[model samples]
Each structure stands twice: as structure tokens, then as C-alpha cells.
Target: MAVNRACHLIEELGCGTVLNGMLDYYPTKEEVQKVTVNPQRINKLLGVNVPMDQFINILERLEFKCNLISSDKLELEVPSFRLDITEDADILEEIARIYGYENIPAADLEGNATAGVKTENQKFMDKVKENSIACGLNEILTYSFVSPRGVDKINLPENDEKRNFVKIMNPLGEETSVMRTTLIPNMLNVLATNVSHKVEEAYAFECGNTFTPQNGLPVETKKYCIGMYGKEVDFFSLKGIVETILNNVGLKGYEIESETTNSTFHPGRCAKVVYNNICVGTFGELHPDVIENYNLGQRVYVAEINADLVFENITLVKRYSALPKYPSTSRDIALIVKDEVFVKQIEDIIKANASDILESYKLFDVYKGSQIEEGHKSIAYSITYRSAEKTLTDEDVAKVHDKILSELSEKLNANLRSN
Candidate 1:
């Protein structure tokens, strides 16, 4: 059978040697001084008309033994398994695959065609993956090389600078030896491998690049991590899907705050997603020993974000307003305060004292227990009070909502939860 298909193409090309039985290939005066060949680079890469004695009769009918070495090169020899004929356009694609690309001749394709626009950081990461797939998430794409026990399974902290990473000196083991400096421990190990295959309710998300080892090179960044689990994933349902992917990346005044130094989150259910003032990421409820080190039986809720600081603080030009012709007056209030008062310090004391018909305020409700007292906590907000030239009544929002409930009762001593 043709010597068993030439001994399976000389043992699939690792062709060492095989004398009398026929398959002896050698070539190594530095692979015959690196097999040169240039009849004008085989007539400018096979556009054909290959002359110089038909390119030295197609290198002596492919037994390739050439020699001339320079009035335009030629040295040839190659055959220790023809290690991909090193260069000169791989011997002009092996002379257009043995000079029979139907005798070559198909030109017309030389220039001007352009029409491919996207950059503005790829249209702001495609509108942050179209608002994280319209909020139901599911994008996941893990492994920017992980597992240095993912910073001790996200318990991180012993001098945590995300446990300073970037190892992989030749890793293909020890669980991919390092590089990911946080993408929520591989998006909580892919939502704990889709909740161990039965997938109760995921939501996942990831938009990559994390590395951080600076100074010896490796700075990467561009993040966005998100995760979720079922049984109503908490921490305000992943802070309303990280404020709808930072309002689909056009970001804007951002601020979330409450995070207490990140031992992989959950210290008071976490927060910190600031903006113009930088911090740009962190969302909570995962640290129950990082959900039992990823066994993840429900309740996950995560968020990473800093998608390069929301692509350098987004808002790529947009300014439209003019539709308030009056009619807004909401007002709810409720206070009682002291569990270390911070509803962004009572919305920065109703935006530093009702800066004119307040028009927005939210925290719907947040009580503590037994009608609230021992160390206190009752919250509740609602506010809104608009006017673009008319109609905000209820005594025009009760005199700036009673001077924002009298400066949340004289600077956060709070107390007003009666009826």
C-alpha cells in the first residue's frame, strides 16, 4: 500500500531517518542555509508567468535540490519533513501548490474598501453589552487565567491589593497558575457551574481583562463582572442590576458608597460604585465565606464594573430636557435614624438642603424591627417635588419638605417616624 502511505507520511512528518527502506531525509547546514528561493519570489507570489527556466523546472520537479545561492538566491534543499519551507513566502506557497492552481490568474482586489466603524471603546462595549442583555444578564466568559486559589477563594485581605497577581511562568496546571486579579472569583465559578448543572436561576455576566501586576508589565483593567443566584438574589437585587449596567454605560453622577473595605463583600451587604470621584466598582452580598467557597447553594448577588471606569466616565454627549411644565409633588419622609445614619447621609441632607423643589429622592422604605428603636433605623424616602415653571403644590412641597425634615432633625439626630 505504497509502503503503507510512505510510513504514514514518515510518521506524520517528524521524519528522522529511514534508509534503504526509503524515506531518508536530512538537510541541515542550518537547514541548507535556510532554503532560499526567489525567481522574483516566484513571480510575485504566483500571479504566474514563472520564468527563470520555469523556476528551475519547478525546483527540479519538487525534489528541491537547487544551488545558485545569489544572482537572486536559490540555495534550496529542505526535507527533514519539510518543516514548512521556512519563508520567501513559504517558497511562494509551495509554488502555488505545485504550479497547478489552475495556472494562476485571478487579480482584481487591490485597495479602497473601508467602512467599519465602532471604537468609542467599541461603542462603549456595545452599550455595555446592550444593557447587560436588557438586564436579565447571562454573558459570562471566564478564565483570564485563574486559580491561585482565586485569592484564597475571595477571602482576599492579607494585605490585599487583590493579592497582587500575574504568575503563570509556564502554567497549565495548579489550576491555571494566576493572572486574573478579580472577576469575582471567576464569576463565582460560573455561578458555581450553573448551580451544579441544575441551574436554579443564574443571571451571570463578565466583560473581561483584569490583570494588575504593574512595574514588570501587566496592567489590563477593563472589567464588569455581575452574578446572581436564585431564591431572589439579594443586596437589592444586585443593586438593581448594578443600576442597569450604570444606566447602560452613559453613567452620570454615580455613587453607591456603603462598602466597608471589601473582604470580598457582605460587610453590611456592600456598595462602593462611585464615579467622577473614581472608585467605580463593587457591589455586594457574596461573602458568606464567598458563598461557602463556591458551593453556591443560592443567594449570590455580585457586581464588579469598573469597565475601565465605566469607559472613562461615559456620557458621550447627550443633553435633552424640557418637559416639566409643572405637576410633580411626592413627599413621603419617615426617618428615625441612628444605625450610623447613611442613606447617603440622608441624601446629603436632601441634596444640601432642598436645592430648589428637589424633584428626586428614592429609598422607598427600610425599617429595623419591633417598630424600630434599640439603636434605631427606619429610613423611607420618596421625595420628588418638581417645577419647570408651575404646579408643584402641597404648599410647594411643604416648604422644601420642611427644610428636609429640619435637616434630618438637626443634622441626623433624625427621629420623625410617627404616623
Candidate 2:
């Protein structure tokens, strides 16, 4: 496992292919100054007993090249090809002792075998990008590194699991020290630049890997970041844009609630877009603080959806919903209930009492006034009742209506408005 892991690291570091024949020879060092080495990793994984002379002979015979090394082996110039190899003699010993070259086929091979169809996750992202592009969203690319101030400004959790990124060995400066916990900060940067250049109504999205902690390991999550900037942008417009994206991908029966607030959004204007009852992403008006931080001139409404959450919600076949053959009898009722009484709770009570008769329900008005008690609001809802079997009659609806009013009164202590 260690050898394979080392080989993988070497490959990632742009060392030649893992096979012995493909391995690039390190240049001889001009000076044998003590190079800082990760002694444990090197000794346990790459220690060798082969003579340095024999290793040099093997490399020389293969016409393998290296940096300047004197005959005495006292000092040698570091080879550019050996950038990934940190320790002195570690690279040479690894080449000499590790021997799997003879067994590998000499010819270049093609991976033609169909690796089962693209995973559902992959197809979902493809659909996300495709739909986003179709809706006039441009693809964006940004760095993962974020500054401390930037992180704080974006209101990231101090000990956030996602913010625990792999730190650089020697970071250039503090400004680029930490890995980004969220995409909003960088997206805001993009927005600032575009606004400065006089771009109007920018619609952009990005899909990339982000590092977050999972069981003490930095797990890479492939995430999609979306942003929108325009003078006229607002909550519902962005909601419409997101609905188009979600509906196109067939993740139906999702819900959004304005209660899910984030530091990046206007407190009353943000919503958490939930799918399968999981908090997947958010949509809202950019907070005044965020707008000022980015020096953005126009208001921008933005949303981000977890593509993985989306794909998980994807179904293999579309479920069908029958159109109402009978007219939906909708009733509007305004209840003066305590502010603490959730409209959702009242709606749920109505649905529970009405059983299958309630086809759909929506809250169209929420009022607070001197006519009502303090700390209480009047909520008005239009609930459409229908029956699957046949047209629902007024008498049939009245029976369910009485049941709904009774349930609401009992559950929420709500009083229905009287004419």
C-alpha cells in the first residue's frame, strides 16, 4: 500500500509514468548538502541496500540523464526531473529496488472497456450544466484559496469541517492561507470585477472539486457554484431560475421555506431549497453587508444547489400526476393566529383533517395590524379541494371545510375571520 501510495504521489507530482522504464533519472547533485527529508516516509517506503555505483550504472546504461554529480558523490546539482523526490538517495534507491517493469506489457494500451454507464451523479451534473447553459448562464472558474479576512467576511464557520483544507508547506503569504469553505466569496469577486467593467445581468455557474473534512481526512466534494448579478434581480426571479433547473432534471416535489437564513443573505428574503426534506442549498437577496464588502453596485439574487443532492433525488422514470378532471374548489380563509403559530402548521392541520380532499394549498397573505392582537398575524390561505373519483359538490366541500376549520381552531387556536 505504501509503495502504491508513493507511486501515486510521484505520478501526481508529474514524475514520469510508474513503470521502471518510464521513470526519469534524477540529475546528479553538485553538493551533498543535507536536503530536508521526510525521514520516516522515505525510510519505511523507499529504503534500499543497492550500491549507489550499481544504481548509477543501471541508469547510465539506459541512457538515463541526471543533474551534475561529481565522481566522489560529495555534492550534486538537484535535477529538475526529481522535483517530486525530496530526499537525497531516496529517488535513486527507489528506482533500483522497486522492480515491476519486466512484467508490464511493452505496448501502449487503450482503456476501451465500457466502465458501466456514467453514474447517476455524473449524469445529474451534466444535466445541471446543460440546463444552466441553456438558461443563459456562463461557466466560471475560480481559485479555492481564501484569505482569513475573506473567510470571516463571508461568515464561514470558524471550525467548519469544509474549511479545514490541506495547507501549503510554505504558503506565499497569509492572504492565501486557507482553502475556501464556500464558493460565494469568490463568486462575489467575479461579480465585483464584472460590475467594474460595466457588465449587466451576469449569469454564471461553476462546477469543481472542494476539500472538506470527512473522518479526519480531507474529502474532495465535487460542487457546483452558481451566481447571478443584475440591478433588477430579486428573490422570486432567482427562484424561477432555480425551478427551471430543478424541474428540467426531474427532481419534483421539493419545497422552499424563507426560514433558512444565512449571513450572506437578507434576513427576511433568503430561503432554504429543500429536496427530499434535506437542506440542499439556498436562494436569497444578497445581504447589504455582502453587497458592500464586494463593492457591488446593483442588487443580485443568487442561488446554489448541491448537484449531488439533486442527482440523488433523480428518478429513473418520471412519475405521473393526473390533471384535475373536476374543477378544484379553492377556499380562501384568513386566520388571526399568534405569530408563533406557523402557517405550515395550520396548513398541515387543514390537510390532515380534509384528508385526500385537499389537492393543493398556498398562503397568499400574512398581515399584522392593530385590529389583531399584538405578536399575532393574520394568515390567509387558498386551499383547493378535489376528489379523484368525481366532481366535488359544494355540500361535499362544505363538510370538509367545517372539518378543516375545526382542526385549525383546535390545533392552532386560530379564529377564522367573520364577514
Question: Which regions in candidate 1 have their CA more than 4 angstroms from the true location?
Answer: 1-121, 126-143, 155-182, 185-245, 248-282, 285-302, 305-334, 337-359, 362-373, 378-382, 387-390, 395-419
lDDT tens digits by residue: candidate 2, 1-419: 67778889999999867876344466974443233333233333443333456545554454344332443242233344545445655554544445334522355345876667887777778888898899888999888776657756656566755456666557688877766656777788888899889988788888876666457666666666778877666566687778788889887878777653477787777877777679878887888877888888668777766766777776669668977677788889999888767655886687688878888888787778778789888889888888988899999999989988988888788898663
| lDDT string, candidate 1, 1-61, tens digits | 8877777789789785544565547574443435776677578756667766777777678
Clash pairs for candidate 1: none
TM-score, each model?
0.34, 0.59
All models: lDDT?
Answer: 0.80, 0.71
Candidate 2 Cα deviation (angstroms), residue 292: 2.3
Give per-candidate clash totals.
0, 12
Question: What's the distance in Å from true for residue 364, model 1?
Answer: 13
Q: State model 2's lDDT.
A: 0.71
Among all windows of ten consecutive residues in candidate 1, which has the lowest summed lDDT?
A: 24-33
